[model samples]
Target: MTRRSCPCGLPETYEACCGRFHSGAAAAPTAERLMRSRYCAFVKGDAAYLLRTWHPRTRPATLEPDPGTRWTGLEILDTRDGSAFHSTGTVEFRASYRGGSLHERSRFERVDGAWVYVDGDFLS
Candidate 1:
């Protein structure tokens, strides 16, 4: 498969964008970055990174990336401030895939100075 632009909405290539976080080269600096990396993880099937970055309180023991889907694009809708350093955040986005489309409003939390994805609500 030919590598394509990141579905996370970053201008950089996947390898240079969220790939850094997936490869353990860096930590996501903000809730938006964490959200982007998680999206990239889905695109690349980087389950380990997804598991690692997910907030333990809400994370599942395992994930099965849907093989039938081919993700085509992402559009971020909104982001807003949340709680304290250990706080809450939100990311609303739309993702298009071969099978269908998804609109989600994901919730996030900061724990131990790192932003971690907690959960999301499917809006579409």
Candidate 2:
């Protein structure tokens, strides 16, 4: 059987990497893992997973992945305090698309023992 590499840029197959989290078989153990899975969700256009991982206070009523955007790659630039011992963290990343890239520092928080995206600051 053919194996699909994870869009999150991990060495493991999708099923072993972000897919595990996406399928509810396991939860991301750390903030960086959650960030990677969220990136994978965006690439796969999995709005349900995205919404499920979004902080309740910041989560929108609904979400729709942009079909027009073609995601190419992800680069994790920096991270702060997103560890198992920390309740909040920030991830700085650059997500590349077809024509351009998005640079942002995203904030995350542990909600009910699961990491959830809170918000982000766009960077120049």
Candidate 3:
């Protein structure tokens, strides 16, 4: 049987996929979830949710999802245990657009019983 791929790159279903994270299911069991939600937030243009889920220390006071960027999809490549419930995770994916594509490896951390996005490294 062909394996269904997660738009977020994880080998999971859409229902069990990033939707779980966006639906507020534990803000992702690891850093990967945070990264997915952050991506979903961008796709949906949910700046408020993005800001709310971002780590306070690193979270910008204001977030402006790039208007010119049109995110096509997501693909999570690999991940590791950052820590415990509070862990670190990495996601490598490509976001396509009218102009070009953006490849990024985003980082996330779990803090205060919640997952928050810390930062990301542009791979492209």
Best by lDDT: 2
* lDDT of candidates 1 onward, in order: 0.83, 0.94, 0.70
List candidate 1 stretches off by more than 4 Å: 1-4, 82-86
Cα lDDT tens digits, model 3, 2-121, are 666555556786557766666666456667666776777687677887888888889898978888777776666666664454456666667666677778777777777676777878
Ranking by TM-score: 2, 1, 3
- Model 1 TM-score (2 dp): 0.88
Candidates sorted on lDDT, descending: 2, 1, 3
Per-residue lDDT of model 2, residues 1-124, tens digit only: 9786889998899999999999999999888899999999999999999999999999999999999999999999999999999999999999999999999999999999999999999999
Local error of candidate 2 at 8, Å? 0.4
Enumerate residue pairs that collide in model 1.
none
Q: Give candidate 2's whole-model lDDT.
A: 0.94
Over all chains combined, what TM-score does candidate 3 have?
A: 0.72
In candidate 1, position 25 carries an lDDT of 93
lDDT, model 1, position 23: 94
User: TM-score of the candidate numbered 2?
Assistant: 0.96
